[model samples]
Target: MTTALIADDEAHLAQYLKQQLAACWPELEIVSVARNGIEAAEQISAWQPELAFLDIQMPGLNGLEVAQGIEGATRVVFVTAYDDYAVEAFDAAALDYLLKPLKTERLLACVARLKAALGRPPAVDESRLAETLQRLLAPPVQGLARLRFIRAASGDMTHQVAVDEVLFFHADDKYTVVRTAQGEHLIRTTITDLAAQLDPEQFWQVHRSTLINLAHLVGTRRDEMSRLFVRIKGHAQELPVSRAYVHLFKAM
Candidate 1:
C-alpha cells in the first residue's frame, strides 16, 4: 500500500482532504496528519512517505520551506490559495500545484499522476522548486514586507501578538519566546526562522539565540568579564550580545 502525508494548518481542511483521498483512492493510506509546517517536516523526515500534500501557508515554516528540506523520492503536491499567476508558474515548471477549495475531479487527476510516478525515479527538479519559492517569498519594492502579527501558544491558549509590541525574541530549548510589553509567549518557530521573516532594520540578532527590536534598545554596557549586554528602553533585563554581533553597536 502507498503511504501519504497530509499537512495543513487547518485541521478541518486536512481531514476533508483525507476523506477525499480515501474515497477516490482506497489503496492510498494516510500515514500522518500535520497541523503546521514544522510538524509536517518532522513527519516527512521520519516516515518519508510516498507522497506529501502540503499547504502553501503554515505556521513555523511555509510549505515551500518544508518541501525544500525534504529529500529522496517523496513526490509533493502543493496546495495553494494563490492566484492563477502562481498556478501558471508551477504548471510551466512541470510541478504539480493544487488550488484551494479542492475539487474531487482535480484531486482524482493528481492521484492518477501519483500512481503513475510511484516506483519511478523522482522526476521533479527540486532546484527549480527552490527558485520558485524564493521568487514567491520575495517582497515588492513599494513597501517593507514583514510579519505584522505572530500567533504564539501558551499552554492551552493562543495569542495573536502584534509585531511592533515585541521587545525581543529568545530561543529557549525547542521553542522561541516572543517577549512583548505585556509578557512572554511561546512560539513553535525557531530563532533562525523568525529572523528571516522579520524586518532587518527593526529586528537585530544580538546573539545566536537572541534577537532584539531596535526600537526597544536603550544602550549597551560591558560587564566585568568583558561581556557585552544590551539594555531595553523600559525592560530591566539586559540581553547578552555575542562577539560576532558586537560590531553592530561599535558606533554607539
Candidate 2:
C-alpha cells in the first residue's frame, strides 16, 4: 500500500480532502495529517512517506520548506489558494499543484501523472528549480519569494526579525512599515518591494501601499461608503479593504 502524508492548516479542509482521497483511491493509506508546515516537516522526516500533499501557505514554515526538509525521496503535490499568476514557479520547478476546492478530475489526473512519472524517470527539472529558487531570493513578482533578515540597531541589537512574522507591509510617509505582533517597525523599502518578497497567499495587496495578512483577518464589515473594513486580531484599529480586493475575503 502506498503511504501518504497530508499537511493543511485548516482542519476541516484537511478532513474533507482525506475523505475524498480515501474514497477515490481506496488502496492508498494515509499516514498522517499535519496542521502546520512545521509539524508536517517533522512528521515527514520521521515517516518518509512515498507521497505528500501539502498546502503551500501556512504559519511558520510553508510547504516549500517542508518539501526541502524531507530526508529521503518522496513525490510532492502542492495544494493552495494562491492565484494562477503565482503558479508559474511551480510549473518551472516541475512540481504539481492543485487549486482550492480541488476538482476530482484534477486530483485524479495529478495522481495518474505521479504514478506514470514515478514508474519511468524523474519528471522534475532540477536546473530549472535551482534557477527559479535563485530568482526567488531576489524577490520576483508572480514567483517564489524569500525573506530578508533584519537586525535591530539599538537596545536589542542582537534581535533579528524574521520576515515571516510580519503581518502587513504599509507605507508610513516615506518609509515602509512592517506590522507584526510585537509592533510596527520602519524599514527603508517600498510597499511594492515588500509585497514582491511576501508570499501572495499570506499577504494581499488591498491598496496601492497596504498589504494585509490573511491569517490576521478577524472579520470584515462594509462601511457607509460601501468600502470594506477588515478587523485584525491583536490590533485595535480596522484597516480599509479596497473594493477591488473585497472578493478575496468574501467566502472566508
For lDDT, the strongest prediction is 1
Error of 2 at 171 (Å): 29
| Off by more than 4 A, model 2 | 134-252
Q: Model 2 over residues 28-139: C-alpha lDDT tens digits?
A: 7899999997788778767877788888787756776555444345667888887562376567543477789888998888777766766665466544553443354234
Model 1 CA RMSD to the hidden true structure, in angstroms: 12.3
Residue 177, model 2, lDDT: 76
The candidate 1 region of ten consecutive residues with least summed lDDT is 135-144
Q: Give every collision pair in model 1.
A: none
RMSD of each: 12.3, 17.1
TM match of model 1 to true structure: 0.54
Q: Residue-wise lDDT of candidate 1 within 126-230, one digit each (tens)?
A: 445544544565433344367889998767888999989999999876889888887889888876667777898999877656889999899888876565789
